[model samples]
Target: MNTATASNFGVAASAGGPLLGDAEFQFLRDFVYRHCGIALSEQKRQLVQGRLLRRLRALGLKEFASYCELLRKDPAGELGELASAISTNVTSFFREMHHYDLLVEQLLPRWLEEKKGGGRLRIWSAGCATGEEPYALAMVLAEALERTGSKVDARILATDLSPQALEHACAGMYALDRMGGISDERRRRWFLRGEGRYEGYACVHQRLRELVAIQPLNLLHDWPMRGPFDAIFCRNVVIYFDKPTKQRLFDRYAGLLEPGGYLFLGHSESMHGLSDAFDLVGRTVYRKRVS
Candidate 1:
């Protein structure tokens, strides 16, 4: 779709569309679950309909059924679009502050001790939306490295299902107003303020960006990277997944982490009945067992 045409279609979609029917909702729900493991409950019917209206209009399709048909026929190309449309990308810098506090106070300290001589530190920010989580992690790790004067090599792998979000993440830009959680000293050290045309924005410094590798990944599928990571931050991600899918994904995370590596979940999530491979070490935090 050309830029001009796509913009016009988006405007038209905002005007209104036919209501999403039961069959159409069920089709999309199943397709999303099977492909991305996001279980759209019956409650989210309106949400699904609202989010996809733009896509339907963008494709010049009048009905939800037509959109579904296009999805099935062009799974590779269209599935990404569907994922972008349906997935939520709400995030901010230093969100869930306690997790970062724990990282600085306990996790990094212990991990640094474990690699006393010199070693690499790897962290995976699964479902990192719009870069904040991974960037915040980068900032924390960088500070720890500087404070402890450790020669440890630190890197973060930031992955998400949405290509659109990944693009924004790679750009590493944010509105100036979003800097509230950041302190004056840290802001001065880590981000470059925008000028003239880019006023009211800030970009992450080159050094921090270097520490992170942003990529598109669907948690439902096989991961491309091999890892015995020190930590995996999958916060607020599994809320959309069903029990079985969540269980399997948690097991996979356990397998990927080194023994005693950490898994940080969202505030609303827990591993209570999901997996026994990890033991609760703190609120919403789990530590992998050697066994």
Candidate 2:
């Protein structure tokens, strides 16, 4: 078929007629929004046609509407598969390094001082695809604490909606080429080069890996953590959510944070009309109101 309309949110509008194309796209769009609260736009039509065509052919279902019917009925675990196909999982080690730099330069000193008073340090990495960010945070924590001889208990919760992505994060392996922008010293200290069967990859060192616990979590679903978290890195994940969802999510983040705890969102994301419980600290960084 002609693969023209699919976009980032998975489903696209049908360019042609009402029979198969329109029905299939509508089915997918509705299903995704119902499950994840993501809004599908018309610009994604070509993308939907392109990405899901192979599946349609493989199932020997000639008409796209057939797929729609199956999804509408919520057929046997297929919805999860569709979500996996549509969710964007792009990530890397040390992405947008300034955040990490901020952590090291500003946050760590304060964290260390807090730890001296027996404060428990907890960091939540929401939308932590394949575990890179949490592990990186762990490395920073370990290095800083060790240098100061501060005995502080710290843990990172690395969560994502994709179980497959969580599995990759738990495995702690990544393409060596993806390490290009990471500093050589950081790379050498935190990652180990794979050998033999996995010769082309690099894996996070055990010390850092042990600090992060990867779990499957859908942001749109009810959260399971009991927390007054010290910091939360919810970067680059809310751009797809609708206004109401974003507002609700920010409120939830506020509820879980400790007094004066920090919240870090994506570079493009803001709390403009979302929540007033936080004070903007910097670009995409917010400090929870403490009184």
Candidate 3:
């Protein structure tokens, strides 16, 4: 993690305690998991408290339970807004560049040459926040498909639990500053620079933008997409889930994947004890083995 990220985490930890008591923390934990498929751990106590302090104060409820009750009874966009408020949606263009490199250089070629039956390729970016990962995937796919001369159709399903996050993802707009590590050529090819009042920002091109379908999907809830995805990029989202929830989640992911489909998880996450359904494929990648 960078210095800024570490500082943010540190400040969040310090700022969280008084806002949420032990019982409130537990309630928040359950509520988050129940709604979003994120399992909170003991280590997350500070993080949760820190991230949600604003919500606690804004709701005018002194206790977590009271706040939760308000959320439940909220008839408007309250529940969804609550998830949006507490959820962390930090993302950047090509944040984990290696994963995309692996896909373009290695996986695409292998899949094209070897696979005989299905000419359709599906990729799911579960918990895709503000659309960076899926957009990157689309660019890589377009490039790879151009090179291979294969007519196989490709689609990217980008889903997040937060309505606010999904709204941003659909907009496909991002600050140019956030494109720090992205190359100049890619920026020129895939993004349109902002003008007038919106100057200094960039938005994805319509073609690349069309490749992704954004939706508000709670991973903890029933999955709406019927997928035997060629790849599922569900990175960084599961780090907050507890062991049991993680295990069950892995199983569900396994079920969604085509036999031999790939699963890429967060850098800090491991499948060590999660499930027997997948074969480790290095660096947080797993292959859903044909049964």
Best by lDDT: 1
Cα deviation in Å at residue 182, candidate 2? 1.9
- Estimate, for each residue in 1-291, the C-alpha lDDT of model 2 and write its tens digit: 243543333343344322335556777788778777678786766666665665666667666777777776764356545655676877777777888888889888788887887778889999997787888788888888888888877788999876667788899998888778668898898889999999999989888877788887778778999887889999888888889989989999999999899999988889997899999988788999997
lDDT of each: 0.88, 0.79, 0.79
Please count the clashing residue pairs in each candidate, in the order shown.
0, 11, 1
Ranking by TM-score: 1, 2, 3
Give the alpha carbon lDDT tens digit for every residue of 1-291 in model 3.
Answer: 676875443433343344455566677677667766566677777666655667677766565567767756762356566667666777877877788888988998877766535577889999898888889888888777778887677788999877778888888888988888678988998889999988999989887876788888777778877787989998988876788888988999999998899999988889997799999877888999987
Ten consecutive residues with minimal summed lDDT in candidate 3? 8-17
The ten-residue window of minimal lDDT in model 2 covers: 11-20
- Mark the regions of model 3 whose C-alpha exceeds 4 Å error after superposition: 1-23, 37-50, 56-66, 74-77, 113-118
Q: Candidate 1's error at 114, in angstroms?
A: 2.5
- The per-prediction CA RMSD against the true structure, in angstroms, equals 6.1, 4.4, 6.2
**Cα shift from native, residue 103, model 2 (Å):** 1.0
For TM-score, candidate 1 versus 3, the one ahead is 1
Model 2 segments more than 4 A misplaced? 1-20, 54-80
Q: Where does model 1 exceed 4 Å of error?
A: 1-15
